[model samples]
Target chain A: MCNHGIHIMEEVKVIEIKKSIFEDNDRDADNLRADLKKRGVYLLNLMSAPGSGKTTTLIHTINRLKDKIRISVMEADIDSDVDAIKIKEATGVESIQLHTGGMCHLDAEMTRQGLDNVSIDNTDLVILENVGNLVCPAEFDTGAVRNAMILSVPEGHDKPLKYPLMFSVCDVVVINKIDVMPYFDFDLDKCKEYIHMRNPKATVIPVCAKTGEGIDQFAEWLLNEVRNWQNK
Target chain B: MHELGIVFYIIRDVKKVAEENALKRVVSVVMDIGEVSTIVPEYLTDCWRWAADKEEILKGCQLEINTIPAVTHCDDCGKEYPTVAHGKICPHCGSTRTWLLHGREVEIREIIVPNN
Candidate 1:
């Protein structure tokens, strides 16, 4: 049947494309930062390991400063709406929950998606409680104006030495559960030294989320930081 | 793991490229992962294998990782050293005024298609 027909060869083609994997997320984060700045919103990305008392500290912070500034919370977890619900019932402020569908960390794009879920434009403070993980969250920029981490006393003081990247990337470090410092072998001064060794510029705030021992100071510092960020 | 999210991003970008080029299938995706970057190549490949095969075009697509050695440049000493070995401190001059030169890369170096 093909006696008079010409034979044609199927050719495979190779296309070359080089691009950064985080390119889209990074660009989105930058844009989100700019948008937040224009809208006078200060986003604080809070990260830490599981059981770091991030929620307790955030609740304390919200309780202390909600009257002064409009505060909203975006709680991200692998699978749980409990934190967001607790934040709402406890503080009576705007709250949203983000389920990562099993991812251990929140990237800039995920942060932006969460921001879109809530009213981020009108709020003065947007606290992103990132998924409770030490390693992955530090590597992803969540488009927050500033980044902080909560290191509880129970988590040990050598966390900085083990997770240097988290300590180095954070702008502020909160040493939570300081009320139990007497029971644990954690040394505050030594922890501070370790944090400084990793990041000299990080502002270390010691607090007890349970007793609210240093929540006032922490709240004051956060207020000032938010105000300063907005002013800038 | 966050590597799973990254694998999704890779699949998205690769599919977009394949669509634009009118390609039917992809062979492999080469990535330049930094030595100091938080992404582990093994985990990335594991996630890739799980996620990429779900896509019709990326079935059995190989994920090749090219590790970029972490390097840091010292501002005070004007020297470049391995970042993973010495960290933020300059080894030659013992200066803390050092910044990363390259090690945070998580980029796709090449998208390989069958020589179709």
Candidate 2:
């Protein structure tokens, strides 16, 4: 096939894949969505900054629903499984910690692997505690029906302005660490106003996670959302 | 960063394609990165230089990034604007109501190869 001494009217054919490499991850996530739907499991993607009391909120919420429902969590961290260990110790439930190694975000493939270890059958809620980052994690879709973002008081109210994409993508916003509201420069009303401007549909809930304040309302909202999905 | 994992995928896929097609090297890769995707171009470039050097096909390939701007359509005024700005509401109408027209993607558009 190498007889091209000169120009001999060569033919060229380009086969376009027309498929995204991320499609593999999307396919996996779609499978997860189907599995959750079949099992009547409500999946929640919990996102926030590094110290936004995600773990604390998870602890308090799981404690409230521990006896009522079968809850499991997939915790993502950069290095250690410390968060997963903490979640296990706090909730006394089955949780798999996914180590993203040095990656700042967790994509659908990572979540799918974590889901393999945790059984969603006979489970009511499957919570994915995303990596402790605001920007990158928001770009990924983990096939979660509900997207929850935590904003602690110490992180300031200006977070909505700085990282608008994160807040905009979330279905629910939790103002965690409400007990330290007075000590910080955060204005509760101002923060609420910013969030509303960013996303009209997102429900903002303030809670003192460490002190179990307003958690019942938050849990009720979450259960209602899950119930609607289950009923569908 | 998310770019590192993206780089690995790019290299793996491109290398496999080139090998199957009997190609020596890749000259350029045209990638479509959505403006709202939160992937920093600088970080991606840095990661590409480090990761691409390891792949035989993409050892010297130049990654040309074509940014696709996320357009927002205002439901009230029915106008289109580049929604690359964070929390892209309507620039004309002060409505939290809007629709995402494009962006929110990360895909390879085309590839340029060396005929040699």
Query: Which candidate ranks first by DockQ, i.e. highest?
Result: 1
Write the residue-wise lDDT of candidate 1 on A43-94 in tens digits: 9999999998999889988999999999999999999699999999999999
Error of 1 at A14 (Å): 4.9
Q: Which candidate number has the best lDDT?
A: 1
lDDT of 2 by residue, A63-145 (tens): 88878778898988888888889999988998888888888877777787787788867688989999898887886778888
TM-score of chain B in each prediction: 0.98, 0.86
DockQ of each: 0.51, 0.33
The TM-scores of chain A alone, one per candidate, are 0.91, 0.88
Q: When superposed on Cα atoms, how far off is each prediction in RMSD? A: 5.1, 4.8
Clashing pairs in 2: none
Q: Which ten contiguous residues of candidate 2 chain A have the minimum total lDDT?
A: A1-10
- Model 1 vs. true fold: TM: 0.89
The candidate 1 chain A region of ten consecutive residues with least summed lDDT is A1-10
